[model samples]
Target: MTITIQQQFSINLNALLDEAGVPASGFGRSKHVATSMDVGVATAGKWLSGKQIPEYDRLERMKEWLGCSFDDLLGRTEARGGRIPARAENVLLNMVGTRSATRISICPDEPASIRSDGVYALPIEGDVMSPYVVDGDMVCFMPAMSAHTDGVYVIHVAERYIVRRVNLTTRGTVKLIAENARYEAEEVDLAEEVKRRNGVRIVGVVCARILVNR
Candidate 1:
């Protein structure tokens, strides 16, 4: 059966709080849920008990607290080749057109600056990148005209877009490395077809990942 965003959120929130070891007691539950969102403590209490659907503003606040993109938080699911929300697609498009310097950010506690300028909420479609990115992580990107010496990047091979690390050789050979030890890195010449295909585009280099960890 199809589930509404509220239902999905309630399920996910309960799961996250439980995993975080937050007790389901009245004060603990209210405080936990409220901290995750901007809702009032009383409202959170009501939400935890399913007394009512949260208002729109509260939901948006919850999205921010959970760090999931607006779409995923809204429980928009896709099966097979179904279309994703237009707004989500627009966010991806905007990321593509944004400038390079505007696309990167440093990760939490990392001295090195990370990329965040062009973050696309890609709905992962395959398990080729299992265990690292998982199936639902919204991978953000920073744009790069060429591969870095050693860093993960979004590369397009054929018409398929994949996320992998790029290892550039001094002689100009590029290797696509998958973090999952199961996948072997593919080495290719610098001027290969994958580098020039019309569909081959580097969405961006991963900057930071925001997932709902309760």
Candidate 2:
């Protein structure tokens, strides 16, 4: 039996959600989809029910959130002989705290160490994370709702997104540390920030670094 495009999209989306460890059904599923796709819960419900598909802009957001290719999401891999097109996995590089919308393709030849589903990439643009992760390089991270002190993470604070080494202080504050010593670390009181409408959000945890060739 031939599957309709909506059916195909639903199937593909479910598969990706499964890989991400989301439940197959219920409010949890719809909520995760909504959060990941950055859409309303109703919209996510429609997509999950196969009543509608995402528009191009949302598709781009979905690609980054799910860390999959358009082919994978649109069910085009079968027509392409089961091989994902070269650099099919493209992610918009969120430079500094702004959305640049500049996409960088992940070459198929990338080492397995940095390849994984549900992983997103952010391009480093300055010396803030220097030496450990220099400018012109891209860091691959897994989308995370929370931050841990074990590693570096991309976070939203003071109305800007940045990559920093997170350290949870005993004084109920989160410290954002830059790898470059010249830059002083900043500590934020999460509760106060939220009260002031300046909230701290954990975007993702850095997993691997893709060194760009100069």
The best candidate in terms of TM-score? 2
lDDT (CA) per prediction? 0.50, 0.61
CA shift of 116, model 1, Å = 12
Worst 10 residues of 2 by lDDT: 86-95
Model 2 scores what on Cα lDDT? 0.61
Candidate 2 clashing pairs? none
* TM-scores, each model vs. reference: 0.42, 0.43
The residue-by-residue lDDT of candidate 1 on 28-112, one tens digit each, is 5577777767668887866653345677787677666655555544443442133322222222332323354423332222212
Candidate 1, lDDT over the whole model: 0.50
List, in order, the clash count of every candidate structure: 8, 0
